[model samples]
Each structure stands twice: as C-alpha cells, then as structure tokens.
Target chain A: MNTPTPAHVDGNAAAGVLREVFAVDLTAAVGQCDNCGCAVVLAEARLYTRAPGMVGRCPGCQAILFRVVRGPDRTWLDLRGLRCIEVSLPDS
Target chain B: MGIVSPGFSGRRRTADLPPGQYLTDDFPVLSAGPTPRVRPEEWSFTITTETGREHRWTWREFRALPTERPTVDLHCVTRWSKLGTHWEGVSLDTLLAGVETTADHALAHSYGGYTTNMPLADLRDGKAWIAFRFDGEALAPEHGGPARLLVPHLYLWKSAKWVRGITLLTHDRPGFWESAGYHDYGDPWREQRYWGD
Candidate 1:
C-alpha cells in the first residue's frame, strides 16, 4: 500500500477514534479496471457510485464499472463492460 | 457497474458482501465516506476563521439549520461505488451565508488530519453542508452522525465525515487519504483515484 502524502493546504484535521485507516490487513489487490484493463490497487485508489445500475467511470477510461445487484438469495456483480470476472479466491 | 442503491435493499446486500466497502455506481453515493460517531449532546460543530473568530452550535441547533432531504448518488475512490441515498441537513451555502467566511477560507477538515480544499464557489449555491440525517431518520454513527460535511462533487472523501469544526485557511490542504496518495481532486469519472497520475 502506498503511503498517501498530505497535500498540506491550510487548517488542521483532527484525529478520530480510529488510529489507523484500517486495522484489517488487506490482501494484495487484484482489482482490474474493467475499462483499459488497468490493475486497481486498493491501497492507492478508491471507488464510488455515480449512477444507478451504471457504475461510473473506471477512472482509467472514464468507463462505467460493474456493480452487484440483488440475486434470488444473494447479490451478484452485474458486469457491464464484459462477462463475469474470475475471482482468484473462492466464492464467499 | 459499481453502482448500488443504498436507498434499496440491494445496497444492503452489497454493503454486507464486501471488504467493508460501499457498493454503488454513483461516485458520490458509494463514496459518501465513512460515517462519524454520533454524539447527541456532546457533539458540537464550530466554524473558525484564521482571524480567530468562531461560531459554535450543538446537535439540537444544527439539526434545525434548514434541513433538506435529497436522494443523490455517491462515488468512491477505490473504483465504482455508487448509491442513491437521501440526506437531510443545512445546505453548505445557507450555513456559510449565515456565518462569516472572511476573506480567508477553510479547507474541508476532518478527523486524523484529514483536510481537503474547498473554494468559496464550491460551498455556495447549496453544493455542500454538514449532514446530520439520512432519509427521514437520524444519521448513523458510521454515516457521520452528529454531523458530517457533504460535498457531492470531487468524490465523497472531500466531504469530510465526523467533522468536528471548520477552520479557515489561507491555502488548500489535503486530507488523510489525499496525503497518503489519493488524488487531490478525486473524480471517479476521471478516475483520479490516487495522487499524481
């Protein structure tokens, strides 16, 4: 994980109850940008929603990513750019 | 693809099946940022300027500061996280207009030295605020309850959660993630997820 440097603008950011960003050790990221096929490093980047069903740009090509919609008993990642991605880990 | 409806049951499922991350397609909703701890009476939100002027208010008064409920999308920095969630609170414009922003300005300041730059115009025209509630219910502690600033644009982290106070700055300062490596302008559409290309 890359250490994020403070841009150092102006003002003070208070510390909260959580000391570190997260205590949970994250596994090496295997996130592929769906668009451009770039690898998404969880340590260095983030994801957010821009619209419904249509996940906003992958940030690589400004391409909308995939999302998980409700399945009968569980939710599934509704891939739009391509077919289902094979996960290295077994299904949860 | 990263889009999810926090307003719907589907989002609940997505939120549950995750690495503790939000699920949504909207850059703003999925990236609504982490919710703050809710401290009803103990909570106090203040606005201070570089000149040493300050204004303080409690959760009670803060809740009454012209609340509005809007269902908007959220974007996250990780990738495609979106949610159409409803928020209620005083508009950032209304809050600023009522107070004195001085010639100096404030960057978005949050817990853990998490601060982001916010130009006057971005805070105007009802673009920002300190949200205290979601939907018609009080905001969850994780959702930055008690109060958290909401900036729909520039990714959700720019909208500091668990915001204790706003300090006027002479210049722009980046927050925790920004300092760590997140892009200064975290545009999900542009995929400006990290610092530097």
Candidate 2:
C-alpha cells in the first residue's frame, strides 16, 4: 500500500514552518465495523504527510479506528485509528 | 512518565514526543495549522507574574478589558513562522499594574506546564497580552480559545495555548514544547524549533 506525502508550502516566516502541508482528498469507502460487525459506508480516508491522516471512525463505536487505503486490486485496511499506542488504561 | 512540570530541570525532548503529535486541518488554514470549528464557550484565562501571584479571568472580563494591538512574529514548533501578527488584548504592562512583581522575580506561565522567564525590563516594555482574538477575529480553540498568553518577542509556543492562568514565580518554568524536546526559546531567525542543534 502506498501513501502520498503532503507537499510543503513555501511562504514568509509569518506563514509558519513544518512547511509540509498535506493535500487531502476525501475518498469514501465501505467498512465492516470490528465491534458490531455492522457495514458502514461513506467512510472517509485522508493521506497525510506523516501517515494516513484519518480513516474510518465508528459512528457506533467511537473506540474503533482504522487506516484504509487501496492496495493493488483490493482495499487495504490497517484497522487502527491513532498512531499512538503507548497510552494505556489503568488495569483493574 | 514523571510528575510533569514546566521548566523542570532535566526536561524531556520532542525527539521523545510520543507519537501522533502532528497538526490538524480543521479550519480553513486560517493563517496556518488546523483549528477546531466548534467554538468552546466555557473556558478560563489566567494571569501569572514572577511574584508567585495567580489570577483567573472569565470571558466577560477578558473581553471587557481594554483592547490593544501587539505586532508579533509567531514561530511554530512545526517550523512555520508568521510575522507582524497584530493581536488585540490587554498589554502585559497594563496587566502588571493589576499585580506587583519585583524586577528580580518574573515568569510567564502557560497550559501544559509551560513557563518562560521574563526580565522586569521586558515586562515593562508593554508588548505582551492574554490574547483572545487573532486576525481581527475571535480566537479559535485550536489557536488557543478563550484566552492565551502571547509573548511576541520569543517563539509562538511561548504564547501558550489553552491558557488557563498565569503564575508569577521567582524562577522560570519551561513550557510543554520546551520540556518535550522543543527549543525552550523558539526563535524563527535562529531556526530553533526542536531540541539539539
């Protein structure tokens, strides 16, 4: 799966740095939610400079996240929302 | 991992900035950086001096206070530099009259445990403010809703986002960006954005 990197825009100091700004195109996709097994469509996908900006958000399960893209003839899904996995909930 | 505090000795660096610390594109890239579209009303503002004094400000009083313009050069940790950012807010010098701070003890505080030292002379320069508006409009949340401390002299992060209040301490405290591997003092000219040269 190939992800597109954002192009950095050039401007004055007031324009700000991190020059790279993602040229995002909204692409819709259908997703089978992991939690409820419900088929969700019209899912949004974004290609970011650092990574896949956003994927499918479970309107039903806010906890569920994913990173979707087109790979060859198939639609690839990373099935992970945020890049951060270090934060952990307190154990019971 | 430890008790996080601004300007704490032995601070961490952005190199260690956990993951997913990228800017967003919620607003129409107003000037830069993504800002939230939803406007948050129930927010707080604070004032801190080097004298260890702290005060809270509400939206009403914050808006009611005299409005002033400050031409600042804004430097972002992301490396975007915006100059001559004209802001409207009460000047730091005007705010100083509300509380007293000796020339020796003066520091500016921000959200996420960010702090910056200020010389008494600089405080008197009358160029700083708890800005609530930007680009001649209400300050959006992503741009630090409600009110934020704006220090135009240094880097933009020194301005502090989601500003809760200011604390006047005898010593200077490093802010979130400072501790998290960002240059303690972000200078666009120096290109001091992150930790280490």
* TM-score top scorer: 1
RMSD of model 2, in Å? Answer: 18.9
Over B1-197, each residue of candidate 1 has an lDDT whose tens digit, in order, gives 77775576544445432232456543233332333445688888777777778877787877667777766666655444556668887877666765765544566665423466666566778677788777777766666666778877657767777777877777666654454445666655566655553
- Per-candidate TM equals 0.55, 0.49
Per-residue alpha-carbon lDDT of model 2 for B72-178, expressed as tens digits?
A: 65544444445446677777676667776554534554443335554445445775787777878887776766567787665555665556665665655554334
What lDDT is obtained when candidate 1 is compared to the true structure? 0.58
Kindly report the docking quality category of candidate 1.
incorrect
Off by over 4 Å in 1: A1-92, B1-36, B102-105, B111-113
Residue range A1-92, candidate 2, lDDT tens digits: 87777576345753432222212221333555565655555333222322112233556644344544332234444543433222212342
lDDT of 2 at B28: 26
Best by DockQ: 1
